[model samples]
Target: MCKSRILLVEGRRTVGGGQIMSRRICDVLSTNYDIAVFLPDGESPLAELLQDYSLHRYPMLEYHSGKKGVSDVCRFIYNMWRTCRVLRRFIRKEDITVVYVQAPSLLPVVVCAVAGMDVQIFVHLHVVHVDRKVRLLLNVCLQQKCVKKIIGVSDFTLQQLSLKNRRKSVVLYNYIDDCIKKTVSSDTCEKPVISVIADVMRIKGHHVLFEALQSSALNVEVLIIGRIVEVDYYKELIDKKYSFQYTFTGYVNDVERYLEQTDLVIVPSVGFETFSLAMVESWGKGIPTIASDLGGMKELVENFLPQYAEILLFSPGNIEELKVKIETILNHDILYREVSEKVHEVAYNNFSKTSFRKKLLGII
Candidate 1:
């Protein structure tokens, strides 16, 4: 018997957790099904990962709420309509059996394209929609007949849906590579080195982390990984006054190389971060981590590892609280090792590629 055909649609062209998750999904599903991915025409690490698969690229305008003028609105609508037409034609021509929308922004267009077709649609949500209008629109689209499953990277992502729509939603955590080995031990560091593996965006809370470190007396180094997606935000961060030593490594392919040097990893997102693969990656390396007690970060601690919630979480945007947490971990070696060992144990057992593939296959 021939395997069924699945089409994965990714809206954003940027390299982020969502794109990385998409690559993981493709890696898992390709063995069982004939896969084709639709992505924007661009040079990115994500595109490179999917190079081995059947790929189709289009000029995709990413969804944003910052549009002001009438022309901007018109252009957005035109692009949406164009994308819908393209998707509709592709589905019919290729006889696709299932359509997986990787980003929530593409949900509206994907729903329209699959209308009146014998295709099952699955939406994979990565971030919580902060805009009420966008949330309402997504809730409506998710209720369509074609949409079979609403998969959230965390339970926090499904909170935006209507109670009725959420009944159809499932929480599937993102995957971490099992091949990641612990190279640098947490006890080996002399001067502490903290790393933040996220794009230099304001919402990612680079400024918040910097502010927390400003009042600290310890001599530590901070490494800001990933590319600068927001240039203005990068400029603002650079202009700020700080006390600690830091370096901005603009987009490195081998993140594991940098992770080898990191003593502690921080996910200081002040915005609607549904899930963070960086935290999982850090834990897989037996590195202690701290994250803002919001969205998926809070959910992961309270739901899975409730015993260590106090040491692992802090209030979002609370500079004093963050600084104290940093000091608490740095001052005590025993406490740091306990968290590191427990974190690595949990991360390794819970987030395996085998488990992720099983859950995803069961859903589809």
Candidate 2:
């Protein structure tokens, strides 16, 4: 059989969910199909990532949001045009069979429409791009004529997508590797550790986490391990000098190292997560999570894996609810231990590398 060529179009170079998703696709299909990925510029963790896999990559114009105004808008448009040019060239050179658009921002649907190549197109909608109220673009490229499949990381995401395009897309729950599982100890001891591992974003609801920690009676030290999305947002919060017993490890490269000692990882987010890699990784490592009952993660924590019931779910942006959830876990050792016992079984069955690879093979 002739190997089908797959091209992934995503924006960033760093190790985030988008890159992780692309890696899985490459891992699954590379054994049977030729694969190449398109990143904004050839300067990302992906460049290093491609070295380890049977994969290839390319660079287009480096698109960075300039100052927030008309200037930024102009810069975005110019970069996208350059990206479209790269797509034209890449299609002719690689003889690609399918192009996967990773995000609405970086890989604009317009490029694929103009490629004029008979390639299958998949839009992996990772977020509800339209703001809180739900907005969408009517680009004909997304219409049935151009695009073939639309993949939403969660069922909640599919509902949001249905708001704009009345098309029914596939819901593929994000997968985690087995390494996320925690080692089972024959002897167990109660350790005091509770944390929220997520990027510092307004919608992610770090404030709710802060409130939860303040309310907890346990000596709960929140290990904050993620990069800042907005400088002003970080500054506003930092200037106040937060009150929780918090160790702000602003953007650590080694999260797993922190996870090793953690008793619980909190994903108290107020916004929509296409899928929380933090939650998946923590669950895999045997560390239980407490998350917000918001968008996609609700399905990830509640329905898919009920064994992780310790992952207390609270209302989105609700500080009081988060406070109660955290207190219950901190106050009860037996409840935490009961859920902890099931972590290895859940992680191995749901997120093992072997299992994830199998899922990918089936998808591709």
Model 2, span 306-346: residue lDDT tens = 65544467778777777777667656667666666565456
Cα lDDT of all candidates, in order?
0.85, 0.65
> Where is model 2 poorest over a 10-residue stretch in terms of lDDT?
131-140
lDDT of 1 by residue, 1-364 (tens): 8889999998766667788888889989988999999887778676887788898876666555432356646655876898888888999999998999997777887888888989999999887776666677889999988899999999888888899888899999998885354744445666789999998888889888898899889788999998998999999888977888899999886788898889899999987678888888888888888999988888888876799899889999998999999989888888888888888888888889999999999999
Model 2 misplaced regions, further than 4 Å: 50-76, 106-115, 131-135, 163-168, 183-191, 240-245, 305-311
For model 1, which pairs clash? none
